[model samples]
Target: MKVLALKFENYRNLDDAIITPCDGVNVIYGDNAQGKTNLLEAFWMFCGGHSFRGSKDNELIGFGKPFAKLEVRFFGQDREQTASIKFKGNKKQVEINSVAKNSAAALIEKYCAVVFSPEHLNLIKRGPSERRKFIDSAICREKLKNAVVLSKYNRTLNQRNSLLKDIYRHPELEETLSIWDNSLLLNGAILIKQRMEYLQMLEKRAAEYHFGISGGKEQLEIRYLSTTNAEYGDSIEQIHQKLYETFEQSRADDIRNGCTTKGAHRDDAEILINGKNARLYASQGQQRSAVLSLKLAEAAVLSERMGEKPIILLDDVMSELDSKRQDFLLNKLDDCQVFITCCEQSNKEQLKHGKIFNVCNGVIS
Candidate 1:
């Protein structure tokens, strides 16, 4: 799938702009705070339901504007399609080819994309929550069912935690904890299984790519950690039994802790290079290399699953890379349409082939 064009009005600093991206390497470059990231953010919103900047939907609207309008034309599955999303005060809507969509999930799968930025390096360097989110977001994009499993797991976990809080004040709530525990086990186990499978695929892909980037000198490894070490611990049945036992074992502790402690909510994925923890040990260049490899791996994974490669959005990530890495990425981008925001002077030679959009004061010429 490819984004044919992106139309915007009242989005960030972009007042009214329409951009036609190139088939491979469309770079948008400018000085800091010049809306270079905003163009990439627009595409980020296209794939991620929320803004990559963590801004609220309404925040997408230009300051003082009542609403923001975004239209994306995508070529998908041998046909041209359009998706339009609008945001206002506490209101959001999505339309596909002028037909209203029922749920945001329905629209997300229509087009697939993956993004990488400086902030994304945090996935490896940050806490368990970030790592968990990394796996969850990537899995959620590939399979909508993963979202359902995650939602159910979170709801059950929340309810169970509340039950534990109640049990602390009233010992009579002991039995109720079991019911929530069982439910948590059932759903959490499903989530764990899904995540394990997803990570397994991602690890296989990331490892190969990382090896290539490292000139086969270092091996990349990803480890999935769960609550139990039992074989098939990721399986629902095994977890149900294990969770039942764990709850029985932690009956007194749960009452004291006032929260459910065992489940996928606490899961994490660890990245290792040459058997060393990448997050803590990797240098700046190594971190970038790891992230770059992971992103390319993601693209391969998506292509394998979707039977077609999703659109690639490079943003300004390439400019930060060394010439070799930049050239490597530029060469690998042959079959994919890449959209970039860059300054003309960065490399009139490298970007000579892309659709050059001169962005100035919220206008793209």
Candidate 2:
């Protein structure tokens, strides 16, 4: 997918701006706090109807302003399409080609974008929840239906937890917990199955990229840590049975703890370098390299699954990498559309071929 044009209004420091980017690499350069990241955030919202920076709708709106608006004209899947988002207070609306979408997942299904930021370098060193978010986000991009499934699973999990908390006070509610258990088992099984399958595919691609990035001196291994104890090759039925048994085994403990455990929500993705836990043993450089490998692998996997490349958004991550690593990343992204943000023209000589935009105090020139 290519973002042919982007327009923003009352978004952060950017009061009102429109930018038409190139089909290839587009470098957005400026000093700190100059709206470089805000522009990319707008593109991200265009593709997925939400911010990757974790800002809420109100935070995304300009200070002293009541609302924000973003619109994008893009070409994807062999045709041109327009996506627009209007944010007012806590509410937002999404439209594609002037037709409304029921949910953000609907917009994501039509257009997907993958983002890499400085925070992602910590993927190896962070907690399991961060890694899970990485995997789940990639899966949702590849199969939008999984996003809906995940939403339902989270809702069911919340309800089950609420019931578990209530059972502590009224043991009579214990019997009602079975209803939520069944829902969790059904949805959690599918989530576990999809995660396992996707991780298996990701491992092979990531290993290859890591091998090249590390000069074949390091080996990368990824495995899904399923709370259900289901193996990678297990069928959906087998996974469901395991999850049910797990919930049964953990029922008493869950009720006492006031939360449901032993489900997809508690699962993690284990990353190891040469059989050593990367989270514990990998150095800072190695961790960043591993993250780069994982992200490149994600782009490749998405491209293969969608029959086209997804827009790549790099949020000032290059400033964190060395020259060699930056070259590897830029070369890997040559076949796709890329939006890169930087503090200055450090890499201008290398990136001079692409379209360049300058940002200052929310204005782009």
Candidate 3:
């Protein structure tokens, strides 16, 4: 996928900005807080209907502005299309080709993007939630229905937690907890199954990429460690049975802790380098390499699944890598449309045949 053009109105500091990027690498260079990242965020929101930065719709609007609007025209799957997002107060709407989409998933089904930011470099060191987000996002890119599954699981988890709090307050409510338990088990089982399947594919591709990046000196492995110990080959019935049993086993702790203790929400992906925990043993360079490999694997998987490359957004991440690693990243992304944000102008020499846009104080020139 390639972004043909983008326009933003009242979006953060990028008011009335427009950019037409190149089909290859589009280098966006500017000083700090000059809206380079905001430009990438606009494209991300246009494609995904949400911010990778985790900002709410209201927070995405410029100060003193009542709303934010973004329009993007792109070519994907051999055809051109347009996507627009309008956010006002707490409400937002998405449109594709002038047709309104009922939900973000509908928009995502039409377009998909993958982003790598500074935060993603700490994937191995951060908590499990971040890793889960990475897996879930990749899964959603591959299959939009998985987004609905994840949303359903989260909602059920929240409802189950609320019931746990009620049970803590009124022990009599404990008898009624089975209702939420069944719902949680059903949704959580599906999530566990999907995550494991995707992780298997991701781990294979990531290991291959990591081995090449590490000069064949290290072997990377990723294991899906579910709260219920559900295996990848397990049937949904088997997973549901195990999850239901685990929920029953953790009832006492769940009630006392006022949370659902055993579910997909607590699942984790354990990354190991040569049979050692990467988080505990990997050096700084090793950690960055693992993240790079994971991200490249994500792009490869999406390309294979979608039959077209997803637009790659690199948000000020080149500054964190050395020249050699930077070269490797750029060389690996030869087939995808890339947008890279950097604060240094010297890096422009590395991008030989791409558009370079200058951004300053929300203005792009």
Candidate 4:
């Protein structure tokens, strides 16, 4: 996939900006807070209908503006695709090729992109939620059905928790807890299986890629630890039974804690290198390689699934790495379309061609 053109209106600091990026590697050079990252965010929003900065739809608008719009044109699967986003108040709408898309998720494959930023290092040092989100997003790209299962599981969990917290205040609601538990088991089991499938794929690819990225001295392993113990299988009956048993085992503690427990929400991924835990033992460089390997592995899988290379957005991250690491990073993008952001003052000599744009104070000049 390649983004041909992008335009933004009333988005954050960018009042009105338009860009035509080259197909290979386009570098956006500017100082900090000059909207270099915002350009990437605008492209990302049009591609996936999500922002890397985690800002809400309303927050995307400029300070005094009431609305924001991101218009993008790109090519995917050998055909041109265009999308537009218009946001006002708390409402947001998306259009694809001039036709309105009903759900943003429906536009996933059409606007597929994978982003890697400096903040991603937290995947190792941070909590389980971040790691789980990594797994969930990749799985979402692979299987849309997992979204349905995840939604139902989350809804059931919220209802179950609210019931637990309020049951004493209205004892009559206690009986409905069983209904929520059943729903959690059904959906949670599906979520667990999808997570295992994805983790196994990541582990297999990360091992080889990590060695290449790390010069073969370090080994990377991704271990998917389930909230409840159960191996991968096709039997929904067995999964449901195992989850039900887990819920029963945790029931007393959950009642006391006032939160639903024993589900994918509590799951985590452990990284090991050379028979030692990466989180506790890997050096800074090793942790960096682990994160990069996981991302590159995602690209490889997406390429295989779509039978075409996916667009990669590398956001001003190279400035943080040394020369050797930078070369390996460039090699990974050699076969794919990559949008790179860099500061002109930093070894801009090392970054190669596709298109070059200047961003200053939110204006692309």
lDDT of 2 by residue, 1-365 (tens): 88899998898889597889988888888899999999988888866677887788899999999889998899888999998888999888889989988766567666777887787876887788898888888888777589888999999999999888889999999988888888889989999999998888889989998888777789999988887799989999999999989998999999999998678999998899989999999887788788878887898788888887788888886664566666665555567888888875666446745788899898899
How far off is residue 173 in model 2, in Å?
Answer: 4.8
**Model 3: per-residue Cα lDDT at residue 231:** 90
Please give, for residues 221-276, the per-residue lDDT of candidate 3 as tens digits: 99999889799899899999999899889989999999987789998999999999
The candidate maximizing TM-score is 1
Stretches of model 3 off by over 4 angstroms after superposition: 15-17, 58-68, 86-94, 100-105, 165-174, 215-217
Error of 4 at 147 (Å): 0.9
So what's the TM-score on candidate 4?
0.87
Kindly indicate the candidate among 2 and 3 with the higher TM-score: 2
- In model 4, which residue pairs have backbone atoms overlapping below 3 Å? none
The lDDT of model 2 is 0.84
Candidate 3 global lDDT: 0.84
* Alpha-carbon deviation at 167 in model 4, angstroms: 6.0
Off by over 4 Å in 4: 15-17, 63-67, 102-106, 166-177, 232-235, 306-308, 344-346
List, residue by residue over 1-365, the lDDT tens digit for candidate 4: 77888888999898596788877776777888898888888877864676887888788889998789989888887898788888897777889889887766567767777787788888987888989989888887776777878888888889899898887577677787898888888888888878887788788888888887767777888887776777665466677788888888987777778887777789898888888887788787778778888887887787777676777777866654666666666544567777768774543566654566788898887
TM-score for each of the candidates: 0.89, 0.88, 0.86, 0.87
User: What TM-score should be assigned to candidate 3?
Assistant: 0.86
lDDT of 4 at 14: 81
Assess each prediction's global lDDT (C-alpha) against the native. Answer: 0.75, 0.84, 0.84, 0.79
